[model samples]
Target: MGYVLGLGGPYHHDAAACLVGDGRVLAFAEEERFSRIKHHRDSRSAAQSAAWCLRQSGIGWADIDDVAVAWNPYWPNYCDRIGDAELIAELLGPDARAAGAPRRLTVIGHHLAHAASAFYPAGVTEAAVLVVDGSGDGVSTSIHHGSPVGLRTVRELPYTQSLGWMYQNATTHVGLGDWTNAGKLMGLAAYGQPRIELPFLHLTDDGYHLDLTRYGLPPFLGADATSRYTDFSYYRDLKLAYAKAFTDAGVPAQPPGGHHPDRMAVDLATSVQAALQQAMLALATNALTLTGTATLCVAGGVALNCTSNGILARTPAIADLFVQPAASDAGCALGAALECARRRGDFTVPGPRQAHTLLGPEYSHAAIETALAAAGARYSTPDDIAAAAAHRIAAGQVVGWFQGRAEAGPRALGARSILADPRSTTLRDHVNRDVKRREMWRPLAPSMLDLTSWTTTPHGPAEAMIVAHHATDTAHEQIPGVVHVDGTLRPQRVDPQIQPTYARLLREIQAETGHAVVLNTSFNGPGEPIVATPADALASGARLGLDALAIGDYLVDLTASNTTR
Candidate 1:
C-alpha cells in the first residue's frame, strides 16, 4: 500500500494537511491548531500540521509515495499565484530530498478535489455532487456526477455570480462580521423576517446570479477577498461599498462590531439567508435533474452553512444527503489526498463510508499526565472520567471535556468540547458571555445520543453537525440551550459504535438528568483554534474559566486552587 500526503491553502486561509494510506485517512489537521491562530491567515503553509501527521502515522517523508496539492496552477482563468507544491517542497527541506524522498507530486483541480472528498467517502454507488464556495480557480460553483469510477463536472458557474459573495457582503453590511463570520449572519437571520428585496441577487434557470455592478460590490467575492485577507485598507474600502449598497437598497447599514443587530440589520441578514436558501435549492434541483440521482453529496465552503443544508434536507428532491464535515478549505487537503490515492490505483471504487471524523493525532495517558504535572494542576484520577464529567455538567458547571483522538473538522464532536447543562435557559448566554467571550447571538449545538427524539425532520446525516434540524416541542422545553431563536438546532448525533467514550458520557448524563443531550461547543475562546494537545486543553480551561477539565482519566478542577491536591 502506498501513502499519499495532501496539503491545502498556504496562500488561502485554513491551511491544512491530510495523510491517506491505501483508501483510509490516517491523519488530518488544520494549521490553526498548531499555530494558535484563527484560520491561520498568515499565508504560511501546513508544514507543522504535515509534520504532526507524519509523526502520528509513525512515518517519515520517504514513506509518502505521492504528494497531492489542492490547487491547479495551470488554470489559465485566475491570476492569483498558487504555490502549495513549492510550500510542501520547502517543508520537506533539502536534506529529505537528498535522502531520496518518496516519488511524485500531483496537483488536482480545486472543485474536483472537493467532489472526491464528498463522493468517494460517501460510499454510494452513484450521486450528484454540489460544490458551492467562494471562488476557487475563478469558478464559484460547480455540479458533478459521481459513481464508483469517478466524477464528471456537468456544469460550472463563474465567480461573478457568486452566492458566497452576496452572503458575505450582506454579512459585513449587517455588522455580523466578515467572510469568516457568515455563520453568525445565518444565526442572526432567524431573528427577523425576510422583508427586504435585493434586486442585484436573483435566481436564473440553472443557478444563481449576482449583479455586482448594481450595488457597486466587490469585483469578485472570494477571488479579491481571499487575496487581500490581511489588507485592512481593502476591507475598509469593501465595507464602505457594502454600506453604500445597503443604503441604496433602503436599509440603513449597521455599524460594525455591534453586540446585537438592529431591526434593519436583522432584516437584511434574513433577506440574504432566504435568497441563499432559494438559490441553493434551485441549484440542487438542477443537479439532481442533470445527474438523475437521488443521493447528493456536497462540499466546499458554502456546504458549511448548516441553515441552508437543513432547508435542502427537508426538500423532497434530495433523498440522501452527505456533507463533508470539514467542508471548508481545510477539507481540500483531505480531498486532494483522496484524489491522489484514487489515481494511484490504491483507492478502489465504492470506497468506505466515513463513520467519524476522529482522525487527528491522539495523546496517551502518560503524555496527559506529563502535561498536567508540568502545569502543576490540581486534579484527581477519577474511577470513571465520563461519570465525573457528567456529574459536573449536571450540576450546571461548564466542564472542558477532552478525550481520545481530536476531531478533524471545525465542530467539536465530544473529543475537544466544552460541556454544559442544556436544560438551563440562561446557560447559553453565560457560556457565550463568560466563557467564549463572543457575541450572545450565536447559538451552541447539542451532542445527542439519539436525535430522533429531538428533531421533527427526517434523519439523514446528523452524525456530523453539518445540517440543522427543526427542534420538536420536547427539545424546546428540555434542551433550550442548543435550540436557536428559530427553533432549529445544529446537532451532532453521537453514535455509540463510532464514539463509544462520548456515548458513554452521554448515557451518564442521561442517568444524571432525564435528557440525553449536552450543550457542546468547541473548546476554545474567541478567535482561538480548537484545543489539540493536553497543554492546549489545560491552558484553555484555565484561561476560559472552565469549572473542571476531564482530560483522559484525570479531572482537574479549575475552580479550586491551582495547587495539586
Candidate 2:
C-alpha cells in the first residue's frame, strides 16, 4: 500500500492536509485550527497540517509515496494565470528536492478532485456527483457520474454563474467575511420569508447566473486585485449594490451590539438563500436526469448548506444522498489524492471510509492537565468527565467540552464542542450573542445521544452534522434551542458506539433534564476555526463567555467573575 499525502487551501478557506494510504485516509486536519487564523492563506498553508497528519499517523516524509494537491495550473475551463503550480512548488521541502530519486507531485483538476472526494470514500459504487463552489479552476459548478471505475463530467457551469458568490454577498452584508460567512446567511434565512428578488441574481434553464451589471463588480472571479498587496477584494462594488438596495428598501444596517439582521436584511438573506436552493435543486435534478443514478454525492463549498442539503435529501428524484463532511475546499485535497490514486489504474476498491472525519490530533489526559497547569487554572480531575459536563449543562451553565481527536471537517461533533442546555430557547441567544458573538437568528444544533427515540427524519448519517431535518413536535417542545425558526434542525446524532463520551454525557444529561439532547456548537469563538488543542480550548473558554470547561478529566470553572477554579 502506497502512502499519499493530500494538501489543500493555498488559495482559499479551510487550508487542510490528509494522508491517504491504500485508498484509506490515515490522518487529516485543517491549517486554520492549528494556525488560529481563520481560512488562513499562506505559503505554508498545508505544511503545518501535513506535519500534524504525519505526527498523528506515526509516519515521516520518507514514508510518503506521493503528494497530491487539488489545483491544476492549466485547466481549460478557467482563464486564470498558472500560479497554482508555483504555489505547490514553493511548499515542497528542500530535503525532498535534494534527493535524486523521482517523486510524484501530481496536480489534479479542481472539480475532479471535488468529485473524487465524495465518490471514493462514499462506499457507493455508483452515484450522480455534483461539485459547487465559489470557483473551481474557473468554474462555479460541475456535474458528473461517479462509479468505482471513474467519474465522467456531464455538464459544467462557469464562475460567472455562481450560487456561491451570491451567498457570500448576502453573508458579507451581514458582517460575516465574504469567504467564510455563507453558513451565517443560511442560519439567518430560516427567520425570514423571501418576498422579493434583486436584479443581480437570476436562475436560468442551465443554472444560476449573476449579472455583473447588477452585481456592480467586474465579471472576473477575482478582479478586485489592485496596485499593492494583490490581495483580492470580495465583491466591493457588489456589496455596495446590496447596501444601496437595502437602503432603498428601507433596511437599516445592523445596529451596534451584535443583533439579528434587521427586518429587511433578513428578507434579502431569505431571497438569496431561496434562489440558491432553487437553482441547486434544478441542477441536481438535471444531474439525476443526465446520469440516471439513484444516489447523489455533493461536494465543494456550496454543498455545506445543510438547508439545501435537507431539501435535496427529501427530493423524490434521488433515492439516496451523501454530502462529503469536509465538503469545502479542504476536502478537495483528499479528493485530489483519491483521484491521483485511481489514475494509477492498479488498485481495487476498499471498504467505505467516507464517514470517518475524526482524523485530526487527539489529546491525552496528561496533555490536558499540562495545558491547565500552564494557564494556572484551578480544577478537579473528575472520575467521570462526561457526567461532570452533563451536570454543568443541566444546571444551565454552558460547558466547553473538549475530548479526543478533533474532527477534520467544519462541524464540531462531540470531540471539540461547546455544550449547553437545549431545553432553554433563550440559551440560543446567550450563546449566539455572548459566546459566538453572532446574530441571534443563527440557531444552535442538537447533538442527540440516541437516534431511536428522537422525533426527526434523518436523511443521512447526521453524525457529522451535515443534513438539516424537520423537527417533530417532541423535538420542538423538549429541545427548542435546537429547532430553527422554520421548525427545522440540522442535528448531530451519533451512535453510542462511535462517540461513547458524548453519548454518556447525553445520557447523564437525560437523567438530569429528561431529554437526550444538548445544544452543541464548534468549540471556538466567532470567526475562529474549531479549537484544535487543549490550550486553544482553555484560552477560548474565558473569552467566548463559557461558564466552565470539561477538558478530558479536568473540570475548570471559567466564570471570570470568580477565580479560574
lDDT (0 to 1) per candidate? 0.83, 0.77
TM-score of each: 0.93, 0.90
Model 1 C-alpha lDDT per residue in residues 1-565, reported as the tens digit of each score: 6899887764558888899998789999988888888998865467788888888888988788887877755553542233444544654444545555543457777888888889888988899999998766657799999977788899998755567776788887777677888888888889899988787776877767766465555554554644553343544555566567777877877778858778888888888899899999999999999999999999988899999999888888799998999898888889889888988888886888888899887789999999999889999998999999999999999999999989988899999999999998698899999999988888999999888789997365787888999999999988899999999999998989888878989999999998889999999988789998999999999999999999999999999874676
Q: Write the per-residue lDDT of candidate 2 for residues 320-410, one digit (tens) a residue.
A: 8888999998998788777767776533453375655778898887888788888878788888998998889999999999887788788
What value does the lDDT take at residue 47 in candidate 1? 71
Model 2 Cα shift for residue 194 (angstroms):
0.9
**Clashing pairs in model 1, backbone N/Cα/C closer than 3 A:** none
The candidate that achieves the highest TM-score relative to the unseen native structure: 1
Q: What clash pairs does model 2 have?
A: none
| Model 2 regions more than 4 Å off | 42-44, 74-86, 92-104, 174-176, 213-260, 345-350, 452-456, 560-565
**Model 2 CA RMSD to the hidden true structure, in angstroms:** 3.7
